[model samples]
Target: MLELRGLGKRYTVHDREVVALADVDLVLKPGSFTVVVGRSGCGKSTLLRLLAGLTLPTTGAIHHNGGRPKVGCVFQEPRLMPWLTVAGNVGFGLVGKVTKAEIEARVEAALALVGLSDFRNAYPDQLSGGMASRVGLARALVLEPELLLLDEPFAALDAFTRRGLQGELTDIWLARRPTVVFVTHDVEEAVLLADEVLHMDGGRIIGRREVPLPRPRDATDREFVALRRAILDDLSGRAGSSPPPA
Candidate 1:
């Protein structure tokens, strides 16, 4: 388990103190999938960065059940090395840390998990946007991290590719059961992927909604549509006195 207590971050912008996150508290269960959703600059990415230990928190503390677990991060862009092949990029982090044979085995497995095994020798420039994204995901998965953080990783893909990758992510999560924190601006995407969706606004988590639906959820299903609409209404301050339609 992981817990955040009164977590906050401040930045000096133009010599002015800016609060990116403030007094935020959260708990993530082992292997649970959580998605954070909010508008641009609402501190969604800041929260993710703090969780990833990319930056130090200005206030509060983070506690892990067993020391800090290994972490993997996938950003908005693939950020692949132009000169390296897909397999090389996936095993880049393991160089000198693990034996060459082990690196090859792990990279091969990661590539298979992301369905990019055939592209093992492909360079960054030779792959399409979606394939490059898969390579990014494969690189993270090769580490077999306990905590995985994604920052709008599919935001730049076309709609069709995005949906496909979302399904692939769900599959990977189910298979590996890594604690995942995914950040996104798309409510439907959040609803589709998250076990619990966290609503953030003005540098704070304002609300949360549980999704108890089964896997392979149908977006057109009444319950699915209602939940999506309810989250939107709540975020927009348009929620009715009555609960979402049954």
Candidate 2:
């Protein structure tokens, strides 16, 4: 289990203190998936960065059941090396840290998990946006991290590709059972992927909603639509709003 206590972050922007995240208290169970949804600049990215240890928090503390767990992070962009092949990029971080044979085995498995095994030798320029995203995911998964953080990794893809990748991500999460914290602006996407949806506004988590639906959830299902609509309304300060459209 991982626990965050009174978590907060502040930045000195033009000599004025800016609070990006404030007093966030959360507990993440091992193998559970949580999605954070909010409007732009609602501290969603900041929270993920703090979890990834990319930045230090200004207040509070994070506690892990064991010592700090290995963490993997995927950003909005793939950030792949233009000169490296897909396999090379996936194993880039393991160079000199693990044996070459071990790196190859792990990279191969990660690519297979992301369905990108056939593109092992493809360069970044040769792949489409969705494929590049998969490579990014493969890079993170190669570490077999205990905690995974994604910051709108699919936000730039086309709608069709985005939906496909969303399903693929759910499959990966189910198979690996890594504790995941995914941040996004899409309420529907949150509803589709999260075991629990955290609503953030003005740098604070305002609400939490459990999604008890089964896997392979249907977006058109009444319950699914209703939950999505309700989350949207709550985020928009329209709680108890009208029912979802028929």
Return the TM-score for each candidate structure: 0.96, 0.96
Off by over 4 Å in 2: 241-246
Per residue, candidate 1 scores C-alpha lDDT tens digits across 156-175 of 99999999999999999999
List, in order, the clash count of every candidate structure: 0, 0
Sliding window of 10 residues with minimal summed lDDT for model 1: 237-246
Poorest lDDT segment (10 consecutive residues) of candidate 2? 237-246
Number of clashes found in candidate 2 = 0
Q: Stretches of candidate 1 above 4 Å error?
A: 241-246
